[model samples]
Target: MTQQTKGKASALFPLLIFILLFIGTGVLTKDFSNMPLNVAVIIAAAVAIFMNRKVKLAKKIEIFTKGAGHENIMLMCIIFVLAGAFSEVAKGMGAVDATVNLGLSLLPANLLMVGLFLIGCFISITMGTSMGTVVALTPIGIGIADQTDIPMALAMATVIGGAMFGDNLSMISDTTIASARTQNTSMSDKFKTNFFIVLPGALITALILWFITSGSHINQLEDYSYNLVKVIPYLAVLIVAILGVNVVIVLIGGIILAGAIGIIDGSYTGTTLLQAASQGVLNMEDIAIVALFIGGIIGIIQYNGGIDYLLHVVSNKIKSKKGAEFGIAGLVSVADISTANNTISIIMTGPLAKDIASKYNVDPRKSASILDIFAACWQGIVPYGGQMLAVAGLASISPISIMPYSFYPVLLGICGITAILFGFPRRKVKQ
Candidate 1:
């Protein structure tokens, strides 16, 4: 048996510093943009290295570098780069515009709200990012609300809810990659597990939207022109990913296909395609750097027994497998609320959740699902969260105004909690 390390409260000081620095700056400045997450993590990493004086500075640096260079962390960074490239290439080629227009063109006037939600879901799943989906669809949603009787807040909420649906279950989502890798589970497996749990919530949300908007009628219907050919890359990526192909291969193929399509359609020249790909990779630089910093900081903390202390305390309070699952859910939820970023929350909480799953005999896939679902649940509704802030900004309304109408996330939480309490979708633990 491996030797057990004693838990130490001081080991967590670095993490506390990160949270305080990140949240305090946002609160004080009333602008989260004032303190970037990567900068906060770098500061925290510095503090972690400076602490634990008995350990040689050289040894601390080694530990931090080792964590940053860990296989899973490196893989995640690579995937982020590739995902960014594909997304940017696809968008550069007009895939996002085509997809949005196609969905809008096909929607029935009576079911406009429900149609917006479904379109948001499809875009986010294919895009593998909620922020992109919200940005692409919020304007359309705002237009729909302006032309129809739908409340602006409800319309914005619908877009956010749909975006988060895919955020929780999309195979290419960073949250999926982080949760699956940290727990040593396959993306397809986690997607399947997550799909069933969130399906009920999604359906209920659709029904609720339809019920409310069924009586509403649009003042005028506008036709949006789109070329279906531009949407093939997105469809190809989604299909191949769901078929259990390797994620890295899937992303590389997507980038190539999107670039080729863009080139053939005259949407992008060779130079522009390369430039788009470069810009896409650049867009992901901050998150990728943050991931590395977080890995290093977490490594230092774990080496100093912070994680052991966390596990010891959690294991004591969590008496059953069910409780362990709840603990994982709560842990990520709090992390998401604090960071206002679901991807970062998963990165921070995944290791601890993995440990909890191992001790409680909870399926890694289930643990990953819980981590994604709960983080997404809070992310979709938190007033300060990116999704809410983006949609609220687009609608020119308060983020709090969108909260009550965020039915999908609220229902998603209910379904996730119910799955844990009832052990729904029972299956044998993977060997």
Candidate 2:
């Protein structure tokens, strides 16, 4: 490859190696955290050096370093560290139990399950990221289950369900933007189509969750003592996030509040607070490693034109308007599973999706909705995605175990595929 052009295929080899070593090992072990992710990243980065054909040996290492050190990547790493600190510190100070009891106290015991599920949905929709919503709520959900005798899997599903709800429809969501920009459409136009299509499915999911936990016991044993004022940290984070504050600031604020509350209330010593922050940052090591390795490899792939090559190879055989649209969905869904990131899937396939949209005379809005909906649907149920990771972390359960109990994700996927086939939200072609 010339200095002006690096091929995506070659660049992507490190990513492929990482996937095989990391994800494949996790599957083989049935325990995702069995192998430390940083080790996998180190292996992948070593491979990336040899994979570079165009750039000089020195430049290849530079490319890898640059990708790993990107501003966005750095920011995410910071967020991951802060999130870890905030979560650990909060839980250590009795914040998790406090939040849980407050929720239980206000909820009707008979409808407690439904209430938790709805709250999950509400928080996700407001926040616009399934992962973010999950981090903030999953522990609380688990604590509630422990108190109320709600099944762990069933309770975990509530938060997962709600997180995906926002992921699919949030106005400022990365997936939504990726879909819209890829299809050359406005966000407002895509939302109209998506909202109508998912309405039936969302309601059905709510009903199913209600049925699953309708008889949950909310009986009183010893009422746990919780400092109501200690809950302020979580509330502050939520309010800041909802008001469009940047996520980094939100995390830092939460961390500070949690630390201060712990100290002021005698729940923790100053050194303990610092240790909690440090532990939290350490806990995110796996996630941060995954992101950096994936990004570096993906960058190489793009430089090598691997994605473009695939798109070219596939587009020739795709015939007819219907086939073209479905092909686009299939392409993006496979990418999502491979990358385990819905946002990245959309980013990779946005141009291809647009080409199909234009060639088929299909409405751009419909195409964008299809891309976002399908990716979101698959991401929701995938055991490797962030949703599962957070839920599994909270309940100490394998993601696979929760799959069967996650009626909402399964039904939403089915509902989405059916919507596509039946054209329920049929596009009205204008003359």
Query: Considering every candidate listed, which one attains the maximal TM-score?
Result: 2
TM-score of model number 1: 0.66
Please provide, for model 1 over 1-431, each residue's C-alpha lDDT reduced to its tens digit, 9 standing for 90 to 100: 12335579788899889878876787788776577666788899999999999999999999999988877668767866676677678878988677656655776556888888997888778768776666556656766776667899999999999999988888888899999998899999999999999999999999999998878865656567789998888677667754556667877898899899999989899999999999878876766676678778878987898866664554456768999999888878766754566897799778878888888889998999999999999989876565675565545565656888999999999999999999876877777
Q: Candidate 2 lDDT, tens digit per residue, 52-149? A: 56678787666666766766566656666667788889988889889888877777555666776676677666777776777677767778878886
Considering summed lDDT, which 10 consecutive residues are worst modelled in model 2?
1-10
**What's the distance in Å from true for residue 278, model 2?**
1.7
- TM-score per model over all chains: 0.66, 0.83
Superposed by TM-score, candidate 1 places the C-alpha of residue 322 at a distance from the truth, in angstroms, of 7.3
Over all chains combined, what TM-score does candidate 2 have? 0.83
Clashing pairs in 1: none
- Of the candidates shown, which would achieve the greatest lDDT relative to the real structure? 1
